[model samples]
Target: MLRLAALDGQVSSWLDLFGPIVFYLIVWGLVFAGTGLFVGVFIPFITGDSLLFAAGILSAGHSGINIWVLAIGVGIAAFLGDQVGFLLGRHYGRPYLDRRTGAWVQRSIRRAEKFYTDLGWWAVVVGRFIPWGRVLVPPIAGIARMDYLKFVAANLVGALVWGVLLTVTGYFAASIPAVKSAAYVIGGAFILGAIIAGILSWRRNRAAV
Candidate 1:
């Protein structure tokens, strides 16, 4: 049985499905796969801005999820995720693109290319803020044969900043009465939506396989 999530609830519907600790772990995994997994190559919507925000808000309470852990873990996952994308770009970028089937992938490819060209190595960091760009820019950077060490440095800085800032912002928001309530509502909605999106992505990938 499932309960409808209340817009004003302090917690999310996902909390009902798992213990507080388990729920946080699930959030962590989703954050990881959303960017790190190859799934995003085909589906870019899996990025974790919403998840990170939601998780941060939840962590501010007695949610059993440490803010430090969430921030650091997500940062590492993001860095590694881009690494996978970059490697794919370096090794099988265009050839794979030629065989790829879908307008979404193509459009993302074009956007990622332009983004990388305009900003060069900076795209790797800037792309972290963009949904599709987060997933696509890394591979494009690799395709262009951007220096590996430079990419790593930029990638590290971007990941840490993104992870820390978003999570901390959410954490502090929980301290406010009006803002906390509103953020909880927003975060719950985003979590539920991300869960649905993740399920759809998994099913889509399986079908493609």
Candidate 2:
């Protein structure tokens, strides 16, 4: 009876020590996953890579979140987002590719279509790692009439790979003091790059006009 009581107390103590960490992981995981879905599907400007990297950094310490959970959450979000985009393309057809669509959106679709033509289903997997590729591939695939089953399979694999790679990279990189200190700088660089790309795109469109 004494031994049973002692074991129970130890279990309770351990839970007390770790409970908050577990709760934080769950809450943050859901939030990041939701963000992944939103950014993956709707916002071309926001990249999932950065989010995964941030999650990785958060997952580094003893009280940090579980890497696998973060990866899975983000992966699921990406997959669902891609699926929705695919369905949208399937239903809407190629009207979006015409002049009615914005230049940036059209460019993204064209690039993704070229990838699909060159590499077939492999393009879906490879495209997830690329910035515009991630946003454009699914809809292009749907418009191209690619098999839904095959698309889903490739999407899942790509999402999982992307999530794992970026998260793990961030997680390990955070361990380095220099990387940790410069994380903000790296984030700023991403934003700056996005701005530059947008400006260049706008200039190109004006020239074409």
The CA lDDT of each predicted structure is 0.68, 0.61
TM-scores of the candidates are 0.72, 0.61
Best model number under TM-score: 1
Tens digit per residue, CA lDDT, model 1, 1-209 = 02212221324556666767776566666656655665656534334555566667777875566788877777877788888778888898678555656887788778878767656766777677777778777778888999999999978867876666666666776686566456556545644554455456556767998
Positional deviation of 170 in candidate 2, in angstroms? 1.6
- Off by more than 4 A, model 1: 1-11, 41-46, 177-209
Give model 2's clash tally.
Answer: 0
Model 2 TM-score (2 dp): 0.61
**115-202, model 2: which lDDT tens digit per residue?**
6665666667766667777776777788989999999898877766665555666677767856644654654564455445545655
- Measured by lDDT, the strongest candidate is 1
